[model samples]
Target: MARAGSVAPRQRASAAPESGQRPGRRLLPRSRILLVLALVAALGAAGFGAWALYGSQWLRIEKVSVAWESGSRRELTADQVLSEAAVPLGAPMASLDKDAIEDRLLAALPRLKSVRVVRAWPHGVGLKVTEREPSAQVPAPGGFAEVDEEGVRFAEIAEPLPSVPLLEPDMADAPSVRRFDEERTLREAVAVAAALPEPLAERTSVIRIASYDAITLELSDDRTVRWGSPEDSSAKAGALTILMKAAPDARHFDVSVPSAPAASGG
Candidate 1:
């Protein structure tokens, strides 16, 4: 011990980094936790944006294309009819009502026999229409009513075709003309026309369905074809061809029974 001012040699301080770093070790875990939270938040935000853009009602029918079958291939543009039909643009594709649209279209175009509606994904609707085909014309009280293959009376025409056959009563005791049976008589008439020989068919101008069992055909040459039933029509037609060739000058020929060879008038 010296006098009042005494100085002990200072011990050499340790210069190597501290063997253990508590603050840095603690900070590493806290930084990792913050990084994980940030990543999770970013992923959640991305998912939400995707849902709003792709899964919303912004991707709906923007146009329609109407197509017709038979005759002219007229296509009605979407822009012309969509507004009048009241179809909402950008509406959900799942909410589209096809039946309602079909009804509206049919009402607008009465000439259409049937209509089909389809959805072309994303921005379009498709409509396919079938129009009525006029097969025959019959005289009505006011005018001539047009009939289809089904014999359904549709519309009236102002003018009459002179070449068409005039349906008349066969005998004085014949029953009055009844309502045309659309399904049976009309369909049978179409079948008969289709089955007639080209030469005989073109010459035929009038078809009279007297009853379910009796069908009489009046040809352009003022001859008569007594067809008893719709059965064996093709065979009867073939027989007529053979008979007509044999007796060209004959005023009338009856080939009703194709199986039995018979002839009248030379």
Candidate 2:
């Protein structure tokens, strides 16, 4: 023990920290918290989407609409298209077989060149259609069958179209018909008619197919063009234009060999 006068150096207070000092406030990692939040958001979005796509009546097809594409002329009315499409009412918009609907419309209507089936959001199914335009007229059993530029016979008319030319394939003992078939010959004639220059095409009254290589064009004025085969049609057209300009009075033109054209019978 030390002497009385001086207190033995007051016991130094322990400076050591207390044991188990709350380990850095155990906290959730920032990344873990963000991941949990993302999962919750994703679950919520998926639930909402499912409800909208299937469970909700609001997203069902309540109305159907039909429209022409590109202001195409209507051979069949909207009612006719709707009847043929027969899209199931009350079906979920997301559950619709759009391709099937399009196929149905095309199969049922020959006048349609193409069709687009659209989901008009919220509660509608829409149909957009393009109608085939007559490229030529063919004499059929009942009436003249209207053929498009692709040579598809789509519809029939009682009266002939004045603006369009008549396609006359020589089905009577033609050698080309025996070899290439009548359908092929008709297509070839259609190609020649389609390739005719603008005013000339408009003025053409008949496209006569005698043989595969013996296609001819008769203008409204009774002038004739020996167009020969569908091959080199562009060259033939060019030659015909030049020949017409050179000898406007000629009644018959032969442009089978575009390099050497001929005109006669003025």
Candidate 3:
């Protein structure tokens, strides 16, 4: 209520800051949020690395066991094989070469027909081996040799071979020795052995394999069996069984031809 140009003293405002408004709030920019996220990610990675290096149990292979049906159990130990194989104990399971291990085992033990490796989780390995059993003994240059049905020579017998039937060749041209390089003759012998009758097969001492056309047998009694061809060998074997039963004292029985069999009496 003074002059028209005069100012009011009560209208002058105070100089204090506003309530709930921080002065340094503007310094926290978007880059600070990104920095915090990166720090959290680095800590998580470090924790995962620690677990993989020291805490995880999946990195170790604890046990190794082996089992076989034939041969000495102490001959093929899983620990020895695995040690020779050079596989790491704490290595990852996915990095193992199972097939390579099997091949190595086969190379180490030639008597095994097949070998299988099983990997158990967290820390175990199992090995199973299948061994070839000798079924027949054939006359060789040195002495009697043990062979499987495939005619593969495995061991040599000094004397008094097992009482199994001997297989002899009817013709001189037939191969008596089993060559390790050739598999054809061995496979054929296995086929022939499978075809022989159980009773006659048990008595057979040697199996003489010639060309596919001329197959023959030599009995344990120092007699000859003229087996003409491999075809219908089972039938021929059956016929031989009947003839041998009928004339047990016969010296030689020719069952090569089932339709017309010839026999020689003692």
Which candidate achieves the best lDDT against the true structure? 2
Task: State the C-alpha lDDT per candidate.
Answer: 0.65, 0.88, 0.66
Tens digits of per-residue lDDT for model 3, 119-152:
8765777777776555555567877666666666
Q: Each prediction's Cα RMSD?
A: 12.8, 6.7, 11.1
1-266 per-residue lDDT for model 2 (tens digits): 78889678778887675786743555569978998999999999999999989998879999999999876987789999999999999989999999999999889999999999999998988899999977678899878999887989899888888868899987678776768888988877777777777788888999888888888889999999998888988889889999999999999999999999999998
All candidates in order of lDDT, best leading = 2, 3, 1
| TM-scores for every predicted model | 0.56, 0.80, 0.57
Worst 10 residues of 2 by lDDT: 19-28
Q: Clash totals for all models, in order?
A: 0, 0, 10
Who wins the TM-score comparison? 2
Give candidate 3's TM-score. Answer: 0.57
- Model 1 pairs whose backbones collide: none
